[model samples]
Target: MAESLKDKVALVTGAASGIGLATARALIGAGARAVMADRDAAALERLAGELGDAAIPLVTDLLDPDSCAAMIPDALERAGRIDILHCNAGTYIGGDLTETDPAAIDRMLNLNVNAVMKNVHAVIPHMTGRGSGDIIVTCSVAGHFPVPWEPVYSGSKWAITCFVQTMRRQLNKKGIRVGQVSPGPVISALLADWPEENLRKAKESGSLIEPEEISDAILYMLTRPRNVTIRDMIVLPTNFDI
Candidate 1:
């Protein structure tokens, strides 16, 4: 760890688990003090304990605008300023578009897209005022290539991909860097504990990816020079053709 992020403050959503947790760890290891926000209160508390005092935990429901609003300010209060915002919270419900329940689609959209926008609304002003900051979004390879059985998830990821790219263009002049990291299939509690048959299918079909691999990619993006922003990253295991 070269301490590229020394003197910086980072806020990572979905910090209690998976990709978000990995990103938070990477940021903290690189010398940034991180504020972790998540809806899972119990898990968030446990993660906070393990991360020690440098990691601040905020229990926030991404669906709640007010919760999102409180995160950055609280982080600033504790760490002085926010230099990085990682919008990595998301959800998925697998189904063919025609067969998927509308309610499930809405939940997926709300968590995947709306939450990111809400955080951006709350945090970008501080970044703009300071004339610099970094935003890293967790999208998916499904955003680039569709997965038939997971139509809704694909749609949500595609939306994130588009949003991140637009944000990059919109904030470039302000020295605010926006980037996105897409992982093909990560073995996390979410995917690992998926219905047994689905897990078997994924294994048989060879679609598993490692969480640490994606974490490394995220670190690479964050460590790039101030003039550089990793517009998009797509990481997939060689086993899965997609």
Candidate 2:
């Protein structure tokens, strides 16, 4: 019964490192062969080596429509049907509404929101044709609660949250399951560039949440019985009040 994932195919985005990497690891552990996509080519190669041949690494630029188009067919050709998709690619830019550069906002939206839409758009035809698949989106706590300093980031995440929620409602009857996982701040490469003050504050507030924490949540959603759809899950650091 647990072998439900065995031999199944999964595609994960932003999978060179951090949360995406951890999720890929978990999926592979559960017996699903996976395609890991990311823009970081060198890192992708290293990860593919570590995971061996069961993990296929595809270099991708999520901001490019053509790149998005190219990835799906390649994965399908190599892995056959895509039984699961983990849309985990995202970007964060910090600035108040007035201080934020318009270009930065555009990049954030295009990378964090539009890219996700493009991937789903490209893959949905196949999923719908099969009449079954799982779409797992990596949303964030900031999606549910506004992070004032980073309005655009919040807005982008909120959009993803709403998209998956509504998609879940529409696809539930068609054997397609949409699941959203919202993560609070976690230790990742993104955190390496954090301002010292903010880093200190995060640590002072609580222990850093690891990528494995979020990965475990994703694994749970993917492994549930066919009839059981875990629609949404929010993972917050123990110290975060929200």
Q: Give all TM-scores, in the order shown.
A: 0.92, 0.95
lDDT of 1 by residue, 86-122 (tens): 8988887675577778887887798899989888878
What are the lDDT scores of the predictions, listed in order?
0.83, 0.87
Q: CA shift at 19, candidate 1, in angstroms?
A: 0.7
Going through the candidates in the order shown, the clash numbers are 0, 0
Top lDDT: which candidate number? 2
Best by TM-score: 2
Please give, for residues 83-178, the per-residue lDDT of candidate 2 as tens digits.
999999888876567877898788889988888888887888899999989999999888999887567888999999888888888888888899
At residue 117, give the lDDT of candidate 2: 82
| True lDDT of residue 102, candidate 2 | 90
CA-RMSD of model 1: 2.1
Residue 14 miss distance in model 1 (angstroms):
0.4
